[model samples]
Target: MTEENLNTSGNPSIQDVVEQRLSRRGMLRMGVGTAGAAVLGSLSLAACGGGGDDVAAAPAPAPSTTPISLNFPAVAKSTADLVTVPAGYTATVLYALGDPLNAATPDYRNDGTDTNFETRAGDHHDGIDYFGLNAAGTARDVAGSERGILVMNHEALTDQFLHAAGVTANPRPAAEADKEIPAHGVSCVEVRKVNGRFVYQRESQYNRRITPNTPIEMRGPVRGNALLRTKYSPAGTDTRGTINNCGSSVTPWGTFLTGEENWSGYFARSATDDTARGGATAKSVVSLARYGRPQNSASRHGWETAGAADLYARWNISQTGTSTDGTDDYRNEMNTYGYMVEVDAYAPAAAARKRTALGRFAHEMGMFGLAQAGKPLAVYMGDDSRGEYIYKFVSTASWDAADASPANRMAAGDKYLDAGRLYAARFNADGSGQWIELTIANTTIANFANYRFADQADVLVNARLAADAVGATKMDRPEWAAVHPVTGEVYVTLTNNSNRKIEASGSGQQSVDAANPRAYTDAPTAATAPGNVNGHIIRFRETGNEPAATTFAWDVYLFGAEAGMDATRVNLSALTADNDLSSPDGIWFSRKTGLVFVQTDDGAYTDVTNCMMLIGKPGQVGDGAVQALEYTKADGSKLTVNARVGAKPTSATLRRFLVGPKDCEITGITETPDGKAIFVNIQHPGETIAKANIGDATKFLSHWPGNAGYGAGGALARPRSATIVITRNDGGLIGTDGTQVLNGY
Candidate 1:
């Protein structure tokens, strides 16, 4: 979420594995069902608002088997301050930041005067999932295409725009902190198709906001552990709120899993805190440094400096009280974060649970694999940092079809998510990869020299260390992932990495590896952005078509490059003007049409166009041959990497769908059951406004939807993060002719 690269781990880079050149390999067995979308199969679950045990369940319509193809013309790339879709499609604003959810709440006055964000729409909408509602709008209806509930994560904020004249300096005012803290969690809003368009319900009973002040239970092996003890919860059984919620996942039983990312920056540590905790060699001290919270680090929002109230004081991780067990101070407050928080949207009164068995480390997206009738479930995740590793957690209990529409969804999460085996990925030069288990029983982790493991709880709480001990392959900022609906192969987006170097720039700098094979800068805006200026997407198929497989085959699915880049080197995917993109961040596959959507959060290619989203038809892994790319090192040495890449993309296969306004990122998209409409979130428009010029709208980078006539119009409107619904004029399926799907693969 933060543009700054915070990874200091000197683990072996993907370039290290490419140099081996062991041997070529075959593709793994892909699954028969879908990952996130259609894996629910024929089972249908009601939307939120249905009582826990009274919700009705139905079956969904079968997916279309028509061949995949792009039906509409591609929209030309634009730098204009509005969402640009194809000619036949219409984009309508559905929900915006600070929009009131209750009838008692006043309408949003977008000029930074809004309050009680706990009852309003949060900022920076990220990953989202659509839960369909019945025609009556009271319960979930997997078959209901006209209405549903959208559960989305509010990742972070553009603080400069939160107040009337930007944020106060140093010792921040509690008033400013009060509004920002509640805007950083997740929101659940009910939306319906009204008179041929989708609009959010202002007074739906299912609507709720899960802020940092909400009550959440700590579940799994790490619950009640001493490391989680703090003044707020001496028993360590519960914690207050979830912060920096990023990308999300929807379970087969209809629960939402929100990832906690970039949370380490919110805790302020005193310069002498390491000494207070018994020296730098202490286990707690080592963990603090490893998680990027070294001594003297300042809090991100200065919430800790806003008086001594527990709400503000909890942000400070300094040991101030006299108690030795951290029961009297907030020393262990940071430990309560960074895990996946599961929310039952159907049950508004239920407390969200932090599932710790999944492990914690700047989690980006927790993607589920194909859910079978009686097989173990698997969740794939990325750490979302420079030189971080990909991980997967396989549940110990096998899946039961009855749990698909359980009376109590959180109870089902307890059965599957509470106990699991976590594994880190290691890519081989020969196009093969292995998933190394991260458990206390593993000799490599149990006898790690860097940090000794006390038990399974310690291994999971400090998962990065266990991953490092096993020599996992470091990637280029892996963010969001998507699994194919038919083929079942997993695709992960490796967003650009500025820390990547042709030759080592410093002790922890990463070099070009086989997996991350590019280290070139683009002309114009990205001239200074060397080392994979435009990121790429890599996909792999699990061995034996099983989510719990330990071995798999992988290849670069698509390379993120400019249309004019060198084809033999940087433009490895053979991209054209219509399909070229940069820094692929959010990704998802349409269960109805089998089309994968790619969104960007980039600074590398902004000179030519604003960030955009693209739609494409994906092919299976190992569909292309391995290519050799040569690069010159800093010392005048030549380096060659044999990168296994997938099939080339064409105008027919991949094309830009929508381009966002200035200084904003195109993120979080989901479609209706019939694929007739798609909801997209536009985040942080005009975010480049300087702190001194916050109240001056003329100096704002972009006016966005407001200037385009959605909310408060005119030249003085402040840009607000909002959601838009896209639908075809002819009432056809999105990106396709209603009766037929895309014509190309």
Candidate 2:
């Protein structure tokens, strides 16, 4: 459906649209921390120096065998039936939504009568990472290791089913809404496999939840800016919590970096206040607008009107005091979020920090490349919105192999994150891209007519403004970026956006360019409206395939579509049910196994089945020929091109491994280097399960990770966001052959 024809009632408004544009679309047919150097000064220094000397050697390469075949049998349509995998494979649920976060709290009741969410694991787990541990319980790299710490992101909650009684659109008592806030954050769970079965260490000291209540420090250029000075921290040195943490990355030094995305919609702002504060400037207007905190805008949960509790008041972004001073007001509270938060998963005592140097925006996730001591570090990130820009952060300091020690972990982050240059991606029409630096004093950004900048903080906080000033190339919604294992080339998923059209002459805000070639009207489908629907995956190889290179060559890797969509464009890959998917999001490449995992969050195909994940052995870059793409630009001129894209995957090389339940997303993947076991997260299963019906097991849409039989109650009894373990049943390599083998190859 065209944007004009779509209804906008319950739909987010323009302001929310700005915030979510980078995040929202399916293949449419038609469609860290600091701390305590003093107390244990001796202990700290000793631990730091001691661990640095013990660099573990890389594990021996696993024996190479014939490629494994992959295929699956469709099971029951609705019930959470065990996935029919190749005969030698097994899948087990490791952790599920609502599991207790601490040993001190009561375990999950699964009966839907429990309400103590303060200590429970959050719902809708998203991005995650696996950190192997040494035999001594310290974090280390262990090849073929079964024991490690799995740090997972609890992106957000599906509040509709979080409580015993369904939540009212307009609730009377605000306390009912208060409980859900604390449950949204990151969960660091320590897990290990014993006797070939994965199990979480419930009492592990490292098991901790970093929630909205956790105190976090602000770091980088924007540290003490007036914009971040919320009442929670009058000095702007600290903030209460992190929100909307979607995807994440793990550092070589053993810390977790969770990205805060879509954090703007949580607060209530006054429209008049925003207009009065020089919000007309592109920096101010776009900042507030992009974040969805327009003045007078209401919150989805209405927490701001809930009373005098600091907890509720914190959600208010309205300017309350008469003075222009921001102390009593929250004009800048929203700014405190939308950052990359660094959390020490192992050190519960350490507070997390918002690494402002990364540049605040709708951050999807950060991915790092191989590290060398004393060498500059490189990180790749996506803005997660349509028409937004992609970014990379290159650390100023060289890596120090010694920094991997437990004691120097935070120092390692500081060494790398403290002072770094941030650059935005500009994909040219000639299959090449450049990284434009967003520095204030040394560039055209400082001389922009609109916003005045005093230092780097302004440029970092108002990065979009700077990018605009310098004229960076706008992209389709960029999400979940990863570096190719065999080649250091980077790939980003530009999920579909219906608003995009092909521009002929003059450029429009999101006019289609060579980089984003496809532009067409989506056909009416069962689950999706007719508009620009099915999206495509874009891959770029840095000059010479070097992760640290500032220039790169790119191409469209895959175009998503229905099994029988347009043969010319829609079905760019000629994909079948075995591998076709819309709105590709969570993506990862296993460096050790050279396996590319693709996950989908599609409304377009929901009429057929739930979201799914697929595995592919992608061919090397430059493996395909150029193809012609046609579209109509905003200027009403038609544009056509013959551009190169990734080779299409045959059914034999790519296939769906699993599908999620009602209203759920299949995301957050990590695998052992050996490829023996894969960890996948199912987020918000049965998300539509009404609160009133939560007590009735049969009424719930899903009871996954629990036993397949009826009424097998336990932790998994409740429909929850959870992580599952998939392994070969016969204790052999996964996807070893080109055909369906293990089961009966």
Candidate 3:
């Protein structure tokens, strides 16, 4: 959006406000606006209709060898039908909600019969990555290998179905709630493709799970800080489990990094307890409060009352002790989470460590760029909260191919994550942006009146506070981010935020700005609260066209809106039924295929159709900039989005490839290096199934991957979360020359 317009009031549009506040250095960081040109150098669309030269140059040929296509328009009638792909392509249920993590433990009953889940796969699986296999059944990086270790992030539990029955009324029983706590973590399983079918090798030594009770070491600046000390780990040396594991990434060395998000609400802290634990002065309070934790409020699942054991006691964030001398039971234990955790996927039994060096906030996911030897590695992240900032981490040490050894895995992390400076971005009105370093040694951030920092640990523990001190521009809830494989430009999803408005006062009041410009009321739905329900995607290129550069150029790549909405503003590209979407959440750009996968997690338009994923061949950066957005504030004042228009994708160019079942989110995408096969995760299908009928497949909302009739004829077909495989029946490169077979024959 451009920054030229404002209403009667003198207040500048959000774009102008952010531009005025951006440092000159930050503008220079955006490659002085030339980064966009560098990214579009290859795709020349105007000369060959809407398709690129590559498609135009290729000769028209016979149909693909493996006529790949979707098996059905909507395989899932509800949440209970088994989803299938075209014949010759197969689908398998690898893991489901509450599937035990350790084979040493009992297998999942699947008939609403799961009880103990400390060792099982958690619910709501999200982002995932595939690691190739070695000859000796070990994890490796083979470009053409068909077998590998799969690392998946279990974002959170659909507690309504995890227990024997759903959550009881308020002040619920402790044992019932405790059953749901363990089902929220990360799962690593060994998988292989056999004769065109994928199966999980349960007996593989690399198959393991890490839950909330698992013992994990803390690494980086905040490791041993006094604020982190808890009764269970007196020295702040170890913590148990990780929750809210969202989008994740795989390091060049083969380790998996699961992001802990919305982790602050898991504990219960009394008002009196807040004061005893250093009160507001303690970084714990500021950290806890900023992360959405409310004092004296217990989590929806009550694990604190499970028992006197350390497992249950750790969930209590109350200050029960008398002093700060390690005796004052600082219930601030919950603050220790919400950081990026490193899991050794190849060694499933190994404990996952929380990499505090990455800086803690509401992390949605971490995306790593292609690693090059002797070059610094870069990671892009989004804080999944309205008005939060986007961040990136550059490893201090150069990459070395030799560091792939098991012993050197953590060492690689130390070199990259532990020492790098964290940064927040500020987009300028002139189409450029700057990455402001969020370090402690120098800057206005260090003198923040809210929290005092003695070292980098303080800076990380109170990252939001520090960012606020420096006046980093806030954005709509930022979700997943990906770096363009061919262009090296970075794209981020600004998921809808109801709280953002055009006014400066009142709850959820956010002035209309360039980065997050829309503010409109949406029909109320179970998935999202009304206002500003649909979202948009933003893309930028770094200064010097370098991934590690501090400055960059940016623009709104696409806006999410219905076809009937104002095409000039809301529907920037005039997206039609073939490509329109809302609340863009999960996004990925494939390097091998040059195709972008866009998945939606939305509530505003659920009534229209199920959530879907769109496949697109993007044109270039800065294709859809709008100089204004008409947003009326709570007061009488008006607001507008002042963004520089960039090339926008038309409906013909971006089409919906698939739609999920009822109450399900289409997430976790990865593909073979050759781009011949694609994998996607269908999470929490039939989630709306009533608690009373959880065990009955007939009445349940979904029975995916399990044929519908089979579950009704006295067949005990259990609904399970699964990974689906999609490959062309005539086996050919996907999306090549726009002639790839689609919509199953």
Return the TM-score for each candidate structure. 0.93, 0.85, 0.84
Which segments of candidate 3 are over 4 A away from where they belong? 1-92, 98-107, 169-178, 278-283, 325-330, 370-374, 401-407, 525-530, 632-638, 689-699, 707-719, 737-745
> Model 3, range 1-745, lDDT digits (tens) per residue?
0000011112222311111211111111111001111233343111000000001012223433332222223222122234534334434455556555455767766554566666666778888876667646754543433677777877766666555556666555666656677677777777777777666776777777777878898888788787578777778767878887888766656578878877766777776755765667676666566666646766646677666666676777776776564534646587578799988766655667888877888888887654445666678788887677788877787666556444656666777777777887777767778887788875577776766777777788777766766666677778888765445567898877665565655443456677766666556542343345588888887765555788887888777877677765567657776677888888886534446788888767777766777777664565554566666555667655675655666544566766776667778777654456667788777667667775556776665545433222123344556566666666655544333321110
> Compared with the true structure, what per-residue lDDT tens digits does model 2 show for residues 268-354?
776676566765563555467645565677776777777777778778776675655567766668888888888876677888988
Q: Indicate whether candidate 2 or candidate 3 has the larger lDDT.
A: 2
lDDT, model 3, position 283? 65
Ranking, lDDT, top scorer first: 1, 2, 3
Winner of 1 and 3 under TM-score: 1
Sorted on TM-score, best first, the list reads: 1, 2, 3
The lDDT per prediction is 0.81, 0.65, 0.63
lDDT of 2 at 25: 8
On the 0 to 100 scale, the lDDT of residue 741 in model 2 is 14
Candidate topping lDDT:
1
Residue 621 of model 2 has an lDDT of 48
